[model samples]
Target chain A: SQKIEQNSEALNIQEGKTATLTCNYTNYSPAYLQWYRQDPGRGPVFLLLIRENEKEKRKERLKVTFDTTLKQSLFHITASQPADSATYLCAIHNTGRRALTFGSGTRLQVQP
Target chain B: GAGVSQSPSNKVTEKGKDVELRCDPISGHTALYWYRQSLGQGLEFLIYFQGNSAPDKSGLPSDRFSAERTGGSVSTLTIQRTQQEDSAVYLCASSLAGQDRTSWYEQFFGPGTRLTVL
Candidate 1:
């Protein structure tokens, strides 16, 4: 069976520090990977996407790296602030199917 | 532009009862999807619809779960004989089109309907 895993432990970081989240998968190869930010009591909001051929993708203060060979993806938030705190989810599209399989997600807390 | 929208922000129902959740996709979006997020869990794919084509219902958990899209726009997800395990926040998202790689069809999500089956 295919599996996707993210850090189950909550990460606490000081404001202005970089926060990195990890996502690992097994038994499947995805054409593209995506990251999303989800707040409590709300749906996830799409953040960034990186293709298998691309090593890294960036948007403003967010950056994502995809290493298909390692079956892992890293999402980084640079100069993080309190408002940047949220649960981050990593997802991959299932081939031939329009659905996406998401990892458990990592919760980041930026304390001022 | 308006984003995806869902109705009944919250719903509480008894076990064995039926419930219907609605989703209105963004105008012009050709692809719509339904997902369920259990408490503290990741999103679970439920179904997918594209234009006027037959929808892909492989992700539905059981025969009790069914969904339909009308005129390629609005969608309804119906759960018959709802069970306590069905309690979750149902999310809806839409993208411009499916199978288009050139333009990453970013999915826009709705606030979701939080269903509590007791």
Candidate 2:
């Protein structure tokens, strides 16, 4: 069976420090991967999407690296703030299906 | 400019009873999906609908779970003889691409319907 996993432990960091999250998968080749932010009671919001063809992607303060050979993706938030705190989920599009399989997610807390 | 929407923000039902959860996709989004999230867990894909074609019900956990999308717009997920294990937050998502198109877009999710089975 296909599986996706993220670090189960909650991460706490001081404000202005970098926060990194990891996602690993096995038993499937994903055409693309997506990252999302979820709050306590709300649905997940899309963050970034990296295709298999791309090794890395970035936004203003966010960066994602994909190593298909390793079946792992690293998500980094630079200059993190209190508002950037949330649970981050990693989703991969199954090569044979349209549905996405998501990891359990890692929670990050930025303290001021 | 509206996003996906699901009705009954929260639902509490007795075991063995039936419940219907509704979802209204965005105006022009032709792809709709249903997912469930348990306590402190990742979202589980339940079903997907594209246009008016046959839905992909592969992800439904059991026969007690069924869903329908009518007129390519509204969708209803029906659970019969619900069990306590069925309690979770049901999420609905939509994207702009129709089934005919090969290119896909990011899915916009709704607030979700929190179902509590007692």
lDDT of 2 by residue, A1-112 (tens): 7799999999999999999999999997988899999999898999999988899999999999999999999999999999999999999997767777889999999999
Judge candidate 2 against the unseen true structure and give its global Cα lDDT, from 0 to 1: 0.91
Q: How many residue pairs of model 1 clash at the backbone?
A: 0
Per-candidate fnat, comma-separated = 0.76, 0.79
- Give the alpha-carbon lDDT of every model: 0.89, 0.91
Say which candidate scores most in DockQ: 2
DockQ category of candidate 2: high
Tens-digit lDDT track of model 1 for B58-81: 779999999988998999999999
Lowest summed lDDT window (length 10), candidate 1 chain B: B97-106
Docking band of candidate 1: medium
TM-score of each: 0.96, 0.96
